[model samples]
Target: MNKPLLLQAQRPFTAFAVRATPLATLCLVALLAGGCASPSYTITPEMQARAASENPAPPKDDDFPAPGSAKWQQGAFPSLEALRAMRTGMGKDQVRGLLGFPHFSEGLAGVREWNYIFHFRTGAGPDYITCQYMVRFNADVLTHGMYWKGAGCADLLKPPPAAMQPVATVRPTVVAPAKTTLGADGLFRFDGRSLDDLLPEGRRKLDALARDIRSDSGSAGAIRVTGHTDRLGSKPYNQALSLARANTVRDYLVQAGVPAQRMQVQGRGESEPKVHCAQARRAELIDCLAPNRRVDIEVLSGQ
Candidate 1:
């Protein structure tokens, strides 16, 4: 009835289908490429079991119980029954097998004694008392064993209650300034002041003295450095030399941590004679007068 009109209507629908075909093909290509490039993931039973079985490494010493603790004692020291079983005829290797390693083995080359150290806690704090099991051996065979209990270990059976425990009193160490007299011969080369002029022995001694003074300087007060010369040099020259030497000593002390304000330099040239030598001119006489040439270090009260 209307063939030409029906054919004309189908023409527009066919043209629309043709335009959408290229766009659909591009989308399909992108989807297929993405699927090919991506890797698929799946967990097998073996992989799940391996993941469940994997464990972190055991803890090291830093993770173990602190030293001198009950956990430490249990982990380190052997039981009392093991010590009791140690007979006089047990070989060194046998004893080691039962007790593990000794904490300290003394006189190994000459004497045969193994010391096992054990720590015990008496209070809530971390402080612990040490107990040693000393075993003596004759030619590597156990001869006798003894238990040496330390200070607090004696009361192991009945640890004193915290209230009843004898409180340890730590007394403040009183460091007094010592008056140390050093011979002048040991310090300088004859009558020199520069550190280069000091003998090696004298330098060592001075350094040691300076270290001691500096170490205890917290409790040290004024340091008096007095220099004395022999009766050989002129009074003016002796005084000047003595003062120079005293100044040198003061400088060294300052460099060694002693405050500059804490030092007092004086030249008591030939004023103090430790040894009285009669008038003589031989080398022996010169040596006899050596005690007069000296330096005196006096450490006064602390600030």
Candidate 2:
């Protein structure tokens, strides 16, 4: 009896060893030692009944872990690619390859259900939302059904819409500046300088010009109506007469629907001549200088 003396342990140490340990802790230790086998849970009818109930509570007996429990709290931040890789009929190992182990305490082997907590980015900086996901297995333990606890969470797993293409802009057409010459003889009576003195042909030509201007109004710019005379009258008198004739033509054009603001009038009495007559006879000179007495209308294009 003296040779077999009992070994005495400290009272504090004995109390620490007597505390109850969780089954998960024992399984974890066995797994580390490579001696633990994957466990299977028999799905009792009562368990199925509870799962099918409206507003069912968190499952007990290792069916489902309560929210904020140690197993449920172990969440993962999975990428969009990983979430998209999940599909039906995948084996437990394949599912585990993409999304790690279940966040809940469901065993690894022969598990009919796996629940997880996944965090997804909201695409607004670093903002993210936590979602609960569940995967159900068939009798062969292959994945068959997937579900989400939150509304709109499933939509996040789908791809985004395509980008829009830009449209080209069209430019307006611009007509070049053009100059038209009208004989004063055709436009008015001899020595005419007023609207009353305008000949019928002159009024008709002016009407046609107005129509052209109106048709190109969108691209039409400034219009210049210039009057020229033959070298027959005094410089000042010719100048005044030319100016008056130009004004009359411009007024007629305005009344014919050409914009008044876009038109300007000028007179160049005996200044610019198209032909210089050498004839000495008055009638011959008048006829020869006919080209010099005329009205020039120049229309400019839009900028």
Candidate 3:
């Protein structure tokens, strides 16, 4: 080779060799670092014994029904609607008259507990019903308590998943399961007229509910708002209105950062009518068509 050609070839070869050696060294270092290394640990006999020991937590005090105040409602067809509407600290005798004999009772600490579970069959529309009440007492008087639907007892202490939300009913069959019980469920007659009416106070309650949801760091699972109509309206209209009401609340939560997936809404229209005046719904207070116009909210945990 000529001098210039030989020089060029030698220059390229030298550079290639220099880079190859450094690249090989870097790969070796990485391979070594990727391997695991264990630090030394020692456990003495006394240390091992201490580590194996376990202590169970003591039961915490339950601050529900007060001392000597427990009373319950029992028997078939005992007017669950009436009981559900009663106050948390209502008198025991009052509940007895509204619901009938005591099914079962238990005592704890200085207080007593009264439990009621009611079930009913559906008639023309909507099938199956379940109700539960957990009441506590003191001085033979009602003190503190809560209600649950289906097996919602555990819910009083633990909430459900965040992603599991209530939403608009997809169809008649797409009914959402119960999450909790309604506090005051009956005496419907809606004294106020206008089937599509939104109570002036409803906005306030809604704002409060939304505040609770947002303040809870989006913990409230779903906002279930149902809109209903008297038998006078068409099914489609009722369904649409029910959906709109539910979405109105659901959207508010979303704006407050609640996940959209955490909510569901439903509309039964004239389906679940309040049965007290099954024959005629007009005359009675909080009449027979009451069930058609209500919404429910429930919360759950997430995976």
RMSD of each: 32.0, 37.1, 28.8
lDDT (10s digit) by residue, model 2, range 1-303? 543443344655666666545665776854432212244445432332222222323333244345586354848898777776665445666677788777766653555777788888778798888777877766655555677776678777654532333544953433433888999999989888778899999999988877677656366578999999999877666665666678788878876767677888887878999998889899999999999899999997668
- Better by TM-score, candidate 3 or 2: 2
Q: Candidate 2: where is the Cα deviation over 4 Å?
A: 1-177
Worst 10 residues of 1 by lDDT: 32-41
Backbone clash count, each prediction separately: 0, 0, 28
Q: Rank the candidates by TM-score, best first.
A: 2, 1, 3
Q: Poorest 10 consecutive residues of model 2 by lDDT?
A: 45-54
lDDT of 1 at 10: 100
Q: Candidate 1 at 196: error in angstroms? A: 1.9
Q: Per-residue CA lDDT of candidate 1, range 1-303, in tens?
A: 599999999999999999999998976554332222122334332332232223334333243223353312433535544554454434555666677655532322344555566665547988766565555554323333334444544235331222322435863443534888888898889768655677888777777877677556256578899989888756666766676678777766665556677799887777777888875667877899888888888998775
Every model's TM-score: 0.41, 0.42, 0.31
Number of colliding residue pairs in model 2: 0
Please identify which of the two predictions, 1 or 3, would achieve the higher TM-score against the true structure.
1
lDDT of 2 at 120: 83
Clashing pairs in 1: none
Better of 2 and 3 by lDDT: 2
